[model samples]
Target: MTEPDPPPAGVAQALYDRRDGRLALEVVDAPAAELARPHRTNYFTAYWVRAGRGTFHADGTRHPFAAPCLLFLTPYQAARLDPDDHLHVTAVRFHANFLCVETHHHEVGCNGVLFNDPYGPPAVTLDESTEREVADLVARMRAELDTAGLAQAELLLSYLKILLVRATRLKRGQQGTAGGGVRLPPPLPELRELVERHYRRLHAPADYADLLHATPKALGRLVKQHLGKTLTELIRERVLNHAKWELLHTLKPVKEVAREVGFDDELYFSRLFRKATGMSPTGFRAFETDVRGGSNLSMPSARPSIPPPPPTGQNADRPASDPPEPGA
Candidate 1:
């Protein structure tokens, strides 16, 4: 897999890279040009817009939001932000390995609900109060990162979990899955995580069932019941999504892209790609390249070129909070 690009100039530098790169975090206040362009990342990102009005596109859907909302993207998910000048976003990004929902299933409860869901909308619109709460948490994270002292990683993990928990509640409510006493389906979360981790390698329901310690028949039933798709379909969808991202964002050959997503036979991969996406791989690449104005994708550096801190003095005024009226 290609290394993740570093966070852009506006965000804070990574707090730390743990387990040799399983976890990291940054805050972004990127420029208008960068925000308008389409890009893909190999990490889970929670983009909180404190002030802005725009649409955030993920996977093929456009999620529109004013300020005080959170937009989500799982690893390899394609995204683009088109916002007005009032855009002031705080983006928190991390890899799945950093807080693997599979491992911390009970603590965060975000695996299938927030990051891995293929069918639900991607952004969670926060109320004014919720937005402030999340923004406060992010500010705390920024302060903690700057200190870079003892147990900072542990503290950051705790803060991250809190953010996810809050977002999960909002997401569930938005999707009509919220209730006082409702519980998530037992196997659905793990199943989604497994597919995310192994989709390129394991293409069958039985393959996942074996790892989940359940029979293929039982697992298939649970997946279809809760997720509304057969296990094989979910796997194929993920593979195709990643394939499309690679095709659009990178200059790799069709065969190389196919191999990247686990298909060895280029012809077979092309056939499947055409069937699922309604376009041949080469056609998709050409269309996307033209649409993107021929910007070549590259690995974003992990080390951001942080801009100098703003001057500190009595003359410094606080930034404005209200986003402009829709078209204003």
Candidate 2:
């Protein structure tokens, strides 16, 4: 199918409570044109593509999706849609402060499964039953958003929680079914957890292997077999994710950001960042800021007329960068 034309340039602000700056939650029946362009949001977003056949691009992957699918995007994750025909979408957005996805990870299990799992697809295909349930939940959320009542925020949050929980459950079921109900090896899961905890300080796979009580070579082979990436690559990706978050969300110098991510040599860090993302640390910040019109609090009101430069080399084949945190 042919991709739709891009939208014109403009500013697009996300929904947020005017009285409370920290509380940002909105449910909108977004226009197709608004989504046809690459943009980033300060809040987490989920698009319920009610009726559409197109490619959904997020981070650096192109996810071709049809109707009755849910596409997820983390904060500052650049994304766009290209529909073959008319596209109907409803978007639900909420900042971390509004729902604290990490805090509710135990309840919904969406922190990595739905949002941040680098190895997983960014789009989830929903079955008929799951679609109906999600639609009902979204409708209730829309109704609550429109009403001005006591404890409205609490009620809306409950609905959002249910929606996330259901989606996570469906995704997990699909994963298990696809893998013939086989679970990952013990150390693989532990490696991810350890990377999340120590990516800033531990740059070597040997460090993780020691922590997991496995030989480095055995653990490395396991990672390559299951995740299709080297242990070193996994650790580097985690470190880069943190660096991206810091570069976009803070005014910290590139050197400081590099140091925070365990790199003492700023030049080496910049070289690594550029190779992975197709842009230097400084260049990335500048380009993204320009794209957002100097604010990461909202998506472009309109899509940029000029397309972003296509990534080159190794990055061209895989997701090269992580979803950055929103800028203050």
Q: Can you list the residue pairs that collide in candidate 2?
A: 10-301, 10-302, 11-301, 12-300, 12-301
lDDT of 2 by residue, 157-259 (tens): 8999999988888887766221334667676766777888888999998998999999999998977655546788778766876787677667888999999
**Regions more than 4 Å wrong, model 2:** 1-23, 176-237, 243-257, 260-262, 267-328
lDDT of 1 by residue, 1-328 (tens): 1222343333322222243443356655656566677665545788887777886765445556677778787754456788865787777887533565534769989876787667455678888789888978888888888898899978888898999999998888777332232454667677768888998888888999999899999987866554445777678878887887687566788999999889999999998876554456886566434322343333233333344355445424533333334654
Error of 2 at 47 (Å): 0.8
Score candidate 1 by lDDT.
Answer: 0.68
**Per-model TM against the reference:** 0.53, 0.60
Best by lDDT: 2
Which candidate number would show the highest TM-score if scored against the true structure? 2
